[model samples]
Target chain A: MKGFLLTIISALLVILVLNVGYYKEWFQAKPLQYWTDFLKEKDDTLSIEGVMASRYGVAYTMSMRIKQVLEQKHVTNPVILFEPNSYLRDSLHLYPKIRVPEPAVFYYYTGLEGVWINSPDTGKASFLVRISSKGVGLDVIKTPEQRHQLLAFYKKYPPIL
Target chain B: MPFLLFIFLFICYLVAGYGLLTIFKMQLKTAYMITLSLLLGIAVASFVPFLLQLFYIDLNPASIFGSLVLVALVLNIPTWRRIIKEGFPAVRRSFALKPFRILSYEVPYLLIFGFFTFVSIWRCYYLPPTSRDALSGPEAIAEFAVREHTMINSFFNIDLWTTNNQFKSPYLISLQMICKIAGFPFGQVWLSVVFVSFTVFLYHALKERLHPIIAGLLLLLFLMTPEMYAYTFMILYDYSNMIFFFLSLYFLFGYFKSGIRSHFYFAGLLMGIATYIRSETLALAVLFLPAILLSQRRNKDSLAKIVKANAFFFLPSFLGYYLTAQLWIKYYLPIHYDIGGLVNGHLSDWQPLFQRYSDIVTHLMASEFGIHLWGYILYFTAFLFVAEGIFVRRYSRDARNWLYAIFVLYLGVGALGFLLPMMNLNETTKRALFKLLPLAVLYLANNELLIRLSQRISRWEGTPSYLFAREPRPAPTPIAPTPAPAKGKTAPTVAKAAPASASRPSPKKRKK
Candidate 1:
């Protein structure tokens, strides 16, 4: 009876280990599309920007979020490719700059023109963003007209997104 | 390369600590050695670099390596030879079948600990520093050190040193330098190894006093604690403090049993390291001194002898607190506030102070989330200690009873000292209670009522030997009866020494 109990426990342990593996994403080799779709479908519109990904997929969703946000703002003329977003990487690496809400990404959104957006603040709010396009403070988005000019400037960039 | 260096430094620390214990004439228990060595290694890493950095040397891999080499040459190498020649065989023998022959059942508790430990290690790799303190405190301190490649902090741009003076201690910064030297991003794997080793040590400590099964069960209970398991992967120094504080108590208990001066020194040194790990552990020095002195039971000793022993115990602890405060005072910003300020702040405003005290005490009793099961254990243990009084001799000797009493007193008093000054007592209570949790576990595991309850359970479960079971062989010589202290002339009976003072001297003078 004890041996039988031992076998049952061993089986249960194996099952539990496999379940842990599945939840931890250790087993399957899922694509970025799977995650992007999962995030996009998890919530409509703003959820793309809102959803926090696992630490491994932080860069992927970050670049994807920027792509989705630009698509929403009608800045479609430029090709947007985020190359590991050094500004955000460096910001996250910087101890004081990193806060409770996980800093998402600081991307050089290269389109018709390349822009460096330093989004140190990651929260429910979308208004507080630090973006620099063309030159220092050239199309800095402090107000609506500046936001439009920034988008218009990006609208001239080649479509690669 | 960085991973290899971390492993290398870790092994060097283990060897160093093991050798030191052997030199101190400790029994050389592997679990105890592993845990003690890891903590001592961290303290050494922190202190060595700190002294180097004082001379305008940059705190980097080269300096850290140089410090390790100096330590190895000075103390570790000679001690290592003695440890291998004399201690290795004894340690190996402990793992032989002789110890396990008496025990019948190996419960599933170990399996549970293994699962959680595996999960914690996995999470360390998978997760980033997400906890609030981790983001801005020790992890941040390490990042700053690595980025600058120096221990000197030029900018006080962040409020990192207000309540966060604990970070100014070079332990985390030294560790961070090691990690940077190794090439791994700052993760909890190193901390996880330390945490897991601590649990192993806790198990051994308990096993010495209680049934192996009970020890295993209690250890499992401790590991399964929600906050403790989470903090194992979280970059916080509090858990390490918890382990060191518990080890100090373990050594204190060993001293009480054998009356060995080295055991007392070990307790003192571990307490000091605990204080260095977290400033709050400074209270332990104040808490333990009375317990230790009272446990001595030696009234005939000269004043000089008493003072020397007291100095031996407290000097390390004072140094631990000093190492931490000195870093802030000399190099970085001065400590803005401490326990003294808290007392003065509360004293001036009695009404608010009373209100805060009432709220914190009430919350401690009712706290469900942070303190977890340990809170309930504390509540129950306090009740048992009060109700039991000094009427029963659950343990054989009065010194053992006094040691337990002092520890319980320390836990209760230490918990309040941590809570009284806090801005958010509710949020801080869990971590504050962690310092008390190990002591609470010891109390519960050894409580007369709990022992009885467990014996009943063990009988029903068909276990061979119950907790507190007498060995099959005859017991050792009972302590000799001696003159008791006058009533009201002595401190509380819980703080009194053994009945016989002469029995202690032989162990006191014996050299390794």
Candidate 2:
């Protein structure tokens, strides 16, 4: 009887191990998906960027793209005033349908500073992120007038989470 | 070469840990000694780099490695003296190797736990520190510390308005700095050491309470808890905080059962370590104080002796809190943070506290969505609790004690929300509750019904020696004949630690 009980438990534990992803979510992806994706990839291309790209697929790409634009444009200590998640996601229907990550996360990904409309220093932003019917693009505020005008318009939307 | 360096550093940790435990002289099985020493060793060595920074010493590899050896040597001074006095080989001979007698029932649990552990370690190794909490706080600080060779690196000059991670304890910072300097770029493999050691220690602890099969089953459930398991790899303070806090309570329970002073101090040291990891733990440490103060028998132990015992147990955490706050925040960081400003201002209002507790129960504990978050572990606990209430109608001493600790932990985290308004429900309260799971598992292990079933299973398997079956030895006259706790055979007393104070010296001085 003890053996029977042990066998039943052994089987149950194995089943749980295999199906861990059924309940466990790592981020946007299930844990099983992450495992499958991780195991399939070869380690021949090991780098910090590769690891970021692997864990965060599209969100990472967008951050790097913005970073590329900033570096090419020679914007130093780039402070980006971000459009709210409701506007960016619902209005623009952003690719991947994911809301914009808050400023700290953005800062973590790309060393450039990010600020939401509700940020205390939000109006002092050097660059304003604007969304058109086409897609998301970085809008450089050349003067205090443009920064103020943009902040006034952006404040109408819901605060980015 | 880096792998070799990792191994070398680990050996230093082992020696340091072994020495510390040797000084304490707590009687534990070889397995407990080894695993606990390794974990404690890692924790001890983590402080080295931080201490160097506290003294304005550079954090280069050469400085870190040299300081490690020096610290390890200093910690093991007594042990080395013992070895010299009693010949090294004879002292070594005393430590006879005890092979782990793994029964057939334990095989499945071990295999799966081993597999998951490998995955966790690999992920931790392969990935950089990308968690928002770490990157924003400790990891960012560590990266710059390595580059600049100081804890007060350039990471702090930037505006850190969105997160207050900069103010966290330097425990992770110190270890991450040491590991990064030692060549593990991610600087998180130390977590792997902690994880493996804790699992072994917890499993051994559970086995002593019930049959291996039942223990294994409960542990397997704990291992499979979805959200908690994610932390095994993820670099966070909560996991380590939970381990030390639980172990402290375990030893505290032991002291309660055995009437041993060493056990009392050992429990304090663990709580101190936990407090060092997360300073908020110092507040939670007070909840267990009532248990200690109340444990004194009426009129037998003097008020002075009782107060001294309570102070000794609470002192380590106070020291730990001091090291965390005064050294790290007040001195090390180049920023001004109002510690008092972080406290919730509306203390008179009970509404927020009630709201905080409601969210904890509705969203984190009993809600259907909670099953998705924490899986069935909470439900399993609730089920066992109901079963015990209906059928058994009796609780053992340990079970009763465990339930008290679990409630203390639960209400403690909820109270933290009231105390610190910044502590959110999903992240702070949710993760802090990870400490509660093991205590609940212990409660299950001590359940009368579960113990009874485990006994029946063991009897069927032809094992006579089990929990509650052993002959009661005569109460040997203890140093203090303070009343033997009315344990009611509930606590699977793992051999009452015989020598209370005569055996081990008081805190630091060699002999009493």
**Native-referenced TM-scores of chain A, all candidate models:** 0.24, 0.72
What DockQ would candidate 1 receive versus the native complex? 0.06
lDDT of 1 by residue, B1-512 (tens): 66677678777676556556655555444455557667666656656666666666787777768777677456556455655778865444322333433233334556556766766665564445556555434555555666666655422332222234334466665665666566666445667667777777777656644555556656655654555556787767677777777777766665555455666787888888877776656765676666666666544345676688778888877887876765455445433434444553445555655554555556654455324434234454566665545544444342244346445544544355434655345555456556666776766555555555445545555554333432110111112221132222231122222222132223333211
Separate DockQ for every predicted complex? 0.06, 0.32
Residue A104 Cα positional deviation in candidate 1, in Å, after optimal superposition = 16
The digit string of per-residue lDDT tens for model 1 on A1-161 reads: 54345445444543443344222233122222334444554454433123224442433343445556666777644422221223433433422222112221121111122222222111112232332232111122345565445444434332211
TM-score of each: 0.66, 0.87
lDDT of 1 at B367: 59
Q: Single out the weakest 10-residue window by summed lDDT for candidate 1 chain B.
A: B471-480
* Top candidate (lDDT): 2
Q: Which ten residues in a row have the lowest lDDT in candidate 1 chain A?
A: A104-113
For residues B95-164, could you state the per-residue lDDT of candidate 2 as single tens digits? 4456747777677777767766777778777777757788778887787788899978766665567678
Residues A47-70, model 2: lDDT tens digits: 768777767665566777889999
Docking class of 1: incorrect
